[model samples]
Target: MSGSDGSGPAGRDHPFDAAVALKPADTGDGTYTGATHPAYANMVGPYGGITAATLLEAVQCHPERLGVPVSLTVNYAGPVADGEFTVSARPSRTNRSTQHWSLELTQDGRVITTATAVYAARRDTWADTEATMPDVPEPEAVPVTPMPDEVQWAKNYEMRFLDGALPALEGAPESPDSTTMLWVRDAPARPLDFPALASLCDVFYPRVFLRRGQAMPAGTISLTVYFHADEAVLADHGTRPVLARARSNRFGRSYFDQSACLWGTGGELLATTHQLVYFKG
Candidate 1:
């Protein structure tokens, strides 16, 4: 409801709803507009995860939504200024079981983000999981690290860090390993769904900050997520915390690559994500 012009659904009853609330306006054929809320705002723009979810929301709101998400890729072209923004989603292809969509988000008439998603009607198939869940203490065993006041997005979720944190900027030694293991879930126990799961995939802090232990200028340029579980898995998960692990493989001149794995409480691989981030030293 932050940017609603009395045209869209007034559903800010939950934080996840508030994060992806889109005000549908009759802009034209296949084009829509929505407002960004400060509740999910980041340093320079709204959180990339919420923006990604909003793009998916556009497709879900469309009358021709295909199925649940199988994979999604979002590219942050420019900063999404706080205020009204436009999102457009179009079906590129629809097959027997899978559908493909392309979307773009703009503010002030300039494209700030672009995304592509693939959704499909799943069925029983041969399944095998090779990734093992990290052996760690239970979510309740780990202490929740209070989010700093400056980060609005961090406050929306409860992050229990098992290892890796912002190193003291003063004279802190660089960590030999850049991996982090944590348990994450909505702060107020929101139900796990496709949209919420998409947002949670990006809840981890940028790998650079976690490794260097100092907040440098960094942001995700491209993010991609592959969903391994179906709707039933998420519904069964309820409000349980997800076990997540993230690590960086390479950091080059101006970009770095990081990969993360998300697992359900019963050791099911829910999703795997990778991102190329832009950073300034």
Candidate 2:
């Protein structure tokens, strides 16, 4: 797998895989251990998306996992320190067709993250999508947005903005509303998977940044993702870039809510996510 600094065998394993890799710990308590990958590091910690993926990975790797993920909610309780952390996942309840999981990530005995996940055996059922994908130019038509060198995690994805790109760091006019529409895929072109989809749900730059027209201190307090695509749908999407749109509903008291949708190349609604973010001037 590609290691930090982007040095590793090409086409062997993508950086996204390395970032979310977990090892089974010998504790025999169904726990896994993982370290932060420098390639995904943020200013104060590893990227929240990668952390969320790692937590979900723990459950996905579990021997007793019931079915594919239907929903996931991750709460960032505290900053994860830059070293090894342990994660544990347990099924709180299991029904004939669905299972509920509780997960936690800890560093030095301190709980840094907590999550809940729902997995279910899907069956054929009537379905309809009330939400429609927005009309936008194809990914080939949009130019790739250059990521800032310092933003390590941003480098992991190829982003092409259709609108609401980040504003200049200085003297940029504020936007009337926070909305970003883009096409994004893993930089090295990994296949679309649940963990990858979970990470992409967070690919949008904080809504506050787009609204204020400048960078600010902000972090996700909680994020929830609803998976609409099944394994077959994701596999069919392959490495194609996904159309994503994110916008904020309100911003006040140093907090904002962001909601987003990810659509497959075939116009299938792959996932929808909502997050609460905390920010500081």
Q: Per-residue lDDT tens digits of candidate 2, residues 201-255? A: 9998888887888899999999999999999998899999999999999999989
| Range of the 10 consecutive residues with the lowest summed lDDT in candidate 1 | 3-12
Q: Residue by residue across 1-281, what tens digits does model 1's lDDT show?
A: 34456443432467778768676667645577888888898999988889988898888788788788999999999999888899988899999999999999988878899999999999998889999898888999999985677889888888898987545556777777878778899878877887778888888777777667677899999999999978899889988999988899999899999899999888899999999999997
TM-score of every model?
0.93, 0.95
lDDT of each: 0.85, 0.91
lDDT of 2: 0.91
TM-score of 2: 0.95
**Candidate 2 residue pairs that clash:** none
